[model samples]
Target: MHHRRPKNLRKPLLGGGAFLLLAALNAPAAVSFAEQRYHAYKISRPAYQRQYGSWARVEVPAEYRVNAIHAALLHTGKVLLIAGSGNSQKNFDAGTFDTVLWDPVANTFKKVPTPEDFFCSGHSQLPDGRLLVAGGTARYEILDGEVRKAGGGMRVKNESPDKAVTLKKGTVFRSPSGIEYVSKTDVTVPKATREFEVSYFGNGAMKPWKTKVTAAEARVFVEAVEEGPQALTTQAAQYEVVGLHGEDADNVYGLAQKLTTEKQDFQGIRSAYEFDPKAEKYVPVDPMRDARWYPTLVTLQDGRVLAVSGLNDVGDVVPGDNEIYDPKTRKWTKGPTRYFPTYPALFLTRGGKLLYTGSNAGYGPADKGREPGLWDLEKNTFTGLGGLTDPDQLETSASLILPPAQDQKVMVLGGGGVGESEKSTARTSVVDLSKDSPVFTDGPDLPQGTRYLSSVLMPDDTVFTSGGSGDYRGRGGSDVLKAQFYDPGTNAFTEAAEPTVGRNYHSEALLLPDGRVATFGSDPLYGDRDNTKLGTFERRVEVFTPPALHRGGANRPVLGNGPAEPGADGRATFATEDAGRIAAARLMRPGAVTHTTDVEQRSVALELTRGRDGRSVTVDVPDDRTLVPPGWYMLFVTDGDGVPSVARWIRVK
Candidate 1:
């Protein structure tokens, strides 16, 4: 019934009706917003947090924030975050390297003086609690189209047996065809190797020995002094030394093949250093024999470190050459030659052999060195194990030594196809390395195909796995926000509190002394869903408090005074108020992690004995150095409710 009384009344009535209609139309959005707010409130409540756990982003000051390519839990209860040029071309060009020391307990950050680009380097905790970091990027990659000058590896040979010839940077070498190339760095070509050959006579009498001098060679990166195709060398040719005169010029020469404007891969450096946790400084060490990028450093049973697999100084695989570092001598010696892809998942077994989980990060041929096996360093042999599912999709996978080092079970989590491929896998496999055959068996699958998943071993014996991308470098907005806890006892995964940040390539997660997990780094190729925007490196740090930590208030057992340094196979007493409630104790090796590979993390169960006075607990440390590597560990005791106490730092000697 339309009744228009007056002009003003008609306008007022229409406005009121229109307002009512608009309110009705916006009801769904209002309800959705209200529901979202309620959900947020509910999750923030104590009960919800206690059940599903919680995440808190650390407020890192802008200047202190860095691209954390590698992270290590130092013995000082601080974390060493290394960026080292931070994957930025500008930083590399300006020689601006970065490192930061973060004290999680104190919530403080300090900028460290970095000496070199430690990006993509490998690290492991030394027996004395020092972190041994080896290898780094020497030169950034230059794509095909963007390259202006032709460059490649050059072999400088020394024919004289006198002494090594040192060629400084900018030393020029001229091709026979009249093109000039310059050395990018200083190169030392060793003197020729002298050998003696003795020829025996018919009566077994030795004849005069003849000496033979083999040419000594050193490889260095060289580039054309001028840009374009004119400087390209299509065939192998001997190059004359530009400055050397007479015999020196004739004895020392350069040789190279195929210098062109094609793509140039990332070159590596021979620099190495050890981070002293107490001093909070990186002490320079003897450089590695081979320049390496993306290498893997595994601590041997004797506290020596084995370095393997990386892009060399010339941007090629390191071949089968590996080396070992001895802390006693502060020197590196030649190691067994067995090639594996960069950042291969290698676990040291109690039997003194390394188990390769067939899991690796980037850079290798798909067909070679991809088999899961036991590497006998003594014999220099690798015995291949079978039954790994989705073998092709093993790059960027995460592997862990299942809790209780006595069990000797290793698991490989989700992975992706070789080098930027879209293929990924949800498959997980576990192998009982203690078994005679030790073949991988299918474990529970992930919810979806994932890569770069970070798995941390909890003191309570659960593996906290979180954050990965389904696509390469989280392309197409594929960063998975889910987290889960894999219970080795149950051989299944339980959903965990979802993480707000996305972690992908170059990211790492490690367990903190406070029973929480800290995650850092993610370099995505694209930032948006449409894949048009360039991605930014994630510098925000996130900490995840496991559900066990939130259980039944903060009444968890507390770790008091304990042995600062305990010998293996010895009994150590610790003061704890809740000793009577403590059910188990574990020595968890502090993690030195990078690129989703953390061979250092292992949980070794200790024999626990409660003191009669109810104020102390004694734990028997395992004598097996392989099981419990001599280093700093977080000694944690768990109560009957699976709640862990704050960790006590103990160095196992």
Candidate 2:
């Protein structure tokens, strides 16, 4: 029966890999998709809204509330956090900064020099050990490597705030770095307000903590624009910081998103600049693709560059279209698929599925940002497909989860509906892929509903959820130090023995490749305050290791109730498995099958009877008009227990 099979049909896939895959494609034939590349699934309910906070994994500090998150991976398997907030009320909208590192190796945390904490930029690791950062505030935060012009040098403000002025004159020299910037103003006003705002730009030197001053403070390149309608304005221009290479702070450059006047035409600002490690200056190179704002920059396995999404606006209330940027071609192309309007949440699953979860379209109750979605890159434009047991609502929640293994189950930690809630919920849901429903089990619920809670999955298949408050929208909130963990077997959650730091919006929990989990940030929604800061954003990193598992449960193999196989006790071996989850077995007994467990192995026993005329009685289970596969069998019956008393072994060919 082993003849040449059609290319479309490859059968008899046996093993764990096949078992897992079969579950995913259980209904492959029933789905008709427009793009063979991507298949779409439907949902009965519509998706819902936006959640605001500098709530994520950040370790930066400021004198104000934090509101943004930046993630990076170090060679040591440690996760670095650059948390910032642009809504600091200290001196108007001046933001704060902090740096946090979660070391997986040592299972702890450490603090590095603060990176440029601009708003809305992605971080990438370079071939060397340095980081390549791009985008954020329109004005830049330059740090490492920059080459001065052949006979030139660049000078930023270092003295009086009166040296800089804008046209309309509402406010001027309010540096994007959130520090004091001087303007070549009437040069008369003396008290322009001096706050502890720090800007890591100019000179490229590691100034341990120098206060920023205007150019007149023993510097050069002062300006006085007596031009056009924007006349007599001496505004200093700024650029975004890409890196901070202290020792060899040379050949550095800033990248910017292409500016658009009307939001349509993409005037491709394909510029690449070189930074002189010596002079600390910027030199522009030929452009590369169109400029993108807040796009994700990832290094492919093959050393290629890809820029995805952020093709819309920085201030956009919703996520936008997808696009691809190639480094070699220096070109931009639209991505084959559109992304779910998800925010503060995107993951590349262990199964190679791209997940975009929890986002609002506009502003409404229906738009409370409760939609979780997935996309298949193997095929293009394939998403809007998800089948939760409820199949109706999608709530926004965050957590850490270990991937599934033959002996391990994935656990989801603390997640609840976002935006405007009464109390914080500490519910933990666990998914045992080894089962059919991939159903969710309940874990401990927190005292209140943690709106923007954070989690990090540890190595031992256990999940850890840290600090999240019982407050909503920054109103009447209190600290939730009690942490929780999930156990799948019993489908429950319990409080961990330890307590975590109090946290609010824009905090992060990182699991280092080594073994530690770093927790930091609380950029509170109120004005910048210490208790609100958590100091988790500081250098101190906490390490945690959940207890190890002790074997106890019996066998739990994935099988079906298809038919009874001929065994000493009627049970067929799942040895001849396939990519399809549909399994079949035949019984040697003539009676119906019954479930009985022996040493954890399920089997059936049959009893046969003789008819009055001394002949055997038979019962038929029809395969009426179809040819079944070689392994998928039917249970033959003759009188009792669906087993055949005579001619028990029949090979149907």
Candidate 3:
């Protein structure tokens, strides 16, 4: 069942004049507070000094929530999205589904036909510009035909069986089955069971696959693939590109499901094949470490095919064990895993650090969820992100290494882990990934609670979070299908228009071509839902337009005094009760790279923005939030408006 979102939340896309940025108001009356001592860091960008301020307020119905999200990039410079279930969060032959695609230019989510599969893990655009997708119990296309660069989608039934994959040159597609056809008749078709196949094409959308059984090939330990199941998952991912580039969307990477007896003595594995579109036959690359299901494969900028995370040992997560395949070397290297096991998600930072977040104890699919965790590629370490602290109205937390700016910060949103046990949480935590102090601090809480949410950073540093579990902790509560905003300027969050419908398990919020946002997810509340083996998916798609570009500059100086006692861990402590003025103190050090402190007490509005001109000092009464607590603190400074800016160092408690 697919449906379009309601009207109120569907604020149409703003044309040229429809957009405007609200100016910052410094109208707050100045109270006669005592002054305290302080050290100010100078900011060079004056045009942004006062302007980098921000604030956010919730704007939607209090109850609506979001579930799951599916995202893809189109050649049209747009992001196509599909969502499912807020009420039930269905997907797996469970609940209803919706479908929609967003046009960033028009700022609209044009509703499309219901998705064919409730569970599709992979999505990619074809050389002909067709969309290639893999995942679900089996694979099939929601598309109508062939893919061309400029044209829309077309449906081709000849290769329409589950798990048919297509790749275009320059497109991010991989597989052992991507091959070229010697003849149209020569095609290696997958068997009818779950033994799916992924085929990559370089010239045409696809090549002839050799489906016919070859005794000669079988005699040499080659098994003939008859009817195949769909792929485990698919996205526009290719093998890693090391030094130079080679081949193209030349190979196909996907899974083949099989019966138990196939490898009973051993843990049977679905074959992972690569079809060379140029070569037109199935070339066996390395199989997944063995029977791991739903693995995410990404082609690093260096051209290495790194498999992210997925279910192993009967649909559960086996932490660490990052599977890597080298196209040039045609081999596999299992990357380091975090802890013994983790359900961590893999994300690349601006510095190319493969970051994994969230974790689970014991068998991920079976046992309990743990506190937030992260895997750092650069350090080869696994550490906690936040604690049991709940992130409000967020779902399935996400992290992004922001592009450099006044608001440079690693943002973490929502909470929600596996199954009914782990539902929604209402906490939004932002961590300063800098080497020194100010490590993890609670950012603005989500207006509501959610988890399994989606967040992305724009060029200007503005961040967006949308859809997930309503409670947001991910421990099983209300399914949420809504959108929100994070203004790095004020370090606050704001909710968008009301969620037209509730989405639970299957939905996503994606960015569009013209910079608008698209929200697509499951909606069991709708009608005519299909109950397929894949899952009861939803596709209630919605679009959102931003208020205007709010490019923030340097962070404003805190109204606290500093140079206080530090902590063993290195965070600075500010005790307002012990001082005359000021509470929070911000200190930044660019040259020495260490800044930490607390106001002497009783201080406000230090105006560190002028530090770049020289050193700006001010006195104030310590802030209550700072001095009231008895802990170490750190002084940090930023030169941005929309977010906290400049940090010199910190003093721990």
Candidate 4:
């Protein structure tokens, strides 16, 4: 039955203002730690150090209109930018959805048709290179209507004909429906199959589901729904109850029988569609069993996508029971029944269990219930893993399973204090999830506590962190333009080049094929909640050139020939000018990141063996799905100094 959540279930959104106390106590201490490390490495270097990376701003032509509320790096090498309502409630109500395609190679943007108001929808790339977009804004709730209520009563009809069994008048039997009712007058029952009816008292505000049953040798049946109370009286009979629609119907919601005209509507949509990159349009598919908003989609090893928690049609959180989308059948089937905080940052482990890093994208229950853990999908169980000093501060923080896929370490960094407040955290943590009992431990801190930060795994196995705000939604002068890089070897973050423009909420970055990182989109308030002008709606695109790109022309190796496709006898042959000097081969999945969560970003190190001819390298392809799932990948070969060559796109399937 649908019921209001407990008072303790709700949590505050992460923000900057809420972290003042934390910053005052921790910021100075962090500074002292940095001073101690100055002798080891220059801690005060300028953000634009040439040894790190260089950022260049690119202007978009006027004809291109974009808000970039949503973005993804497509397999075709174009960035898909979507902005429904441009973050405006009025536009959302009007159903104004916009989309654009930005081609980095061509340095141009083109307008594209939008499928629906996928304002807060969730998406993940399929193995076929298509993007599966699920959920959207069905409608917005406005508070202009009066509260509605209903009178309670119950009635029953006899289906089977039989001898009359007399029922006494004033029979105080309860109505087994949402309308909490009690018998007002009990009348004599006719032997020709006696039927019963009862009037209920109260509006059935709180009731459980009722089902058909046999009581006192008489059969009683009611429609099985999330509402309608099950009669709980001193009655004796065998009950045969039919299950409700959808698996886990009780917790699925949207089955409430009670009517409440008073509603704050912002309803979530159940529309499920596939974006065909080749056609550059969305193809409608079967709708999901439940409406979802602010959901997260993760691609499973078998190519199906597991869509986790989100708000339901009525804007209430859909507590648990995630669904899976099968690409082959083009249908959504009920997956393992489980409870997950909305948009949980889940990573598929080598063992096939899902690891929730405790860094949810946004919204859902907080407190201990949302703690980090490893979820055994097959058994529908969770193993809670604690150790985060500040779990409440991870609302917009970026988390990732560190590079080289083999390393089972996951990291969470920078977030706000609580709900839409202006306080954030510079704290970062890492945990080796492979451990039997994993727990997060403190890692290097960021330059300052931040939110909306984006961390992309580079070809070199180091992570690149950029774009975020010191405050929530880039408000209160919390814009952070400088970028940083995290080295797993040292567990340290080094300042990198600063971008020409600042990016915070709604911003994103991805590694490009040419070994540079493309950064764009920052719609904190101009087109988001609060609608306050904290920073301009970011439309300008920029690219960050990693230090490897600064090497001498001769030192930068070139791909003489493409590597063999994956699954081809598990061997790949590559020809390059620096083949003799090439020390490593790696495969990097193109990024499809949004909301600071890049569920698609992954890297696999390939075994490199020099060819007998001394002019080519024979790399052994990964045969296990855990190491390299079927999909498109950018293969890069790095020299002894770690300077990588331009990537050659190849399919692992």
Report the number of backbone clashes for model 3: 229
Indicate the worst ten consecutive residues by lDDT in candidate 3. 590-599
Residue-wise lDDT of candidate 3 within 401-484, one digit each (tens)? 443322335556655544434455566666655544335577777665564555644323456665555532222325554556
Q: Say which candidate scores most in lDDT.
A: 1
Superposed model 3: Cα runs more than 4 Å off: 1-69, 78-305, 325-333, 338-343, 350-352, 359-388, 391-395, 403-408, 471-483, 523-537, 549-653
Worst 10 residues of 1 by lDDT: 561-570
Question: Whose lDDT is higher: candidate 1's or candidate 4's?
Answer: 1
Greater-lDDT candidate between 1 and 3:
1
As for lDDT, the candidate ahead, 2 or 4, is 4
Per-residue error (Å), model 1, residue 177: 0.7
Per-residue accuracy of model 1 over 1-653 as CA lDDT, tens digit each: 99759987888899999999999999999999999899788878878787789999999999999999999999888999999999999999999999999999999999989999999999989999999999999899999798899999999999999889999999999999899999987888889989999999899999998999999999899999998789987899999989899989989999998898888889889999999888888999999999999999999888999999999988988998999999989899999999888889899998899999888988889888988899999999899989999989899999999998899999999999999999989999999987877789999999999999999999989999999999999999999999999999999999888899999998999899999999999999999988999999999999999888889466999978877876454888998899889999999999989999999999999999999999999999888888887788899999998899889988877
What tens digits encode model 2's per-residue C-alpha lDDT throughout 1-653?
Answer: 78887755555434556977876786565353433323111111111001100111333333322332555444333455544333232312343444445444344554443333333443333222234444333222221232111111122222234433112211122224432222221111222234455455587654355454433211111111221222222344442222324421121211122212122211111233322212222233333333333444433322223344432222232233444434345344555444332232333333444444332211124443244444565575434433333212223355322322233233333344434444345554444444444445555555556555555443333345656655543344454655665443444555553433455554555543323345544544443333363223222334443332111112111222222323433323322122122122222111000000000000111232223443322223222111111111223222111111112222112
Per-candidate Cα lDDT values, in order, are 0.92, 0.34, 0.36, 0.71
Clash number by candidate, in order: 0, 90, 229, 27
Better of 2 and 3 by lDDT: 3
Better of 1 and 2 by lDDT: 1
TM-scores, each model vs. reference = 0.96, 0.43, 0.43, 0.74
Per lDDT, what order, best first?
A: 1, 4, 3, 2
Cα shift from native, residue 650, model 3 (Å):
39
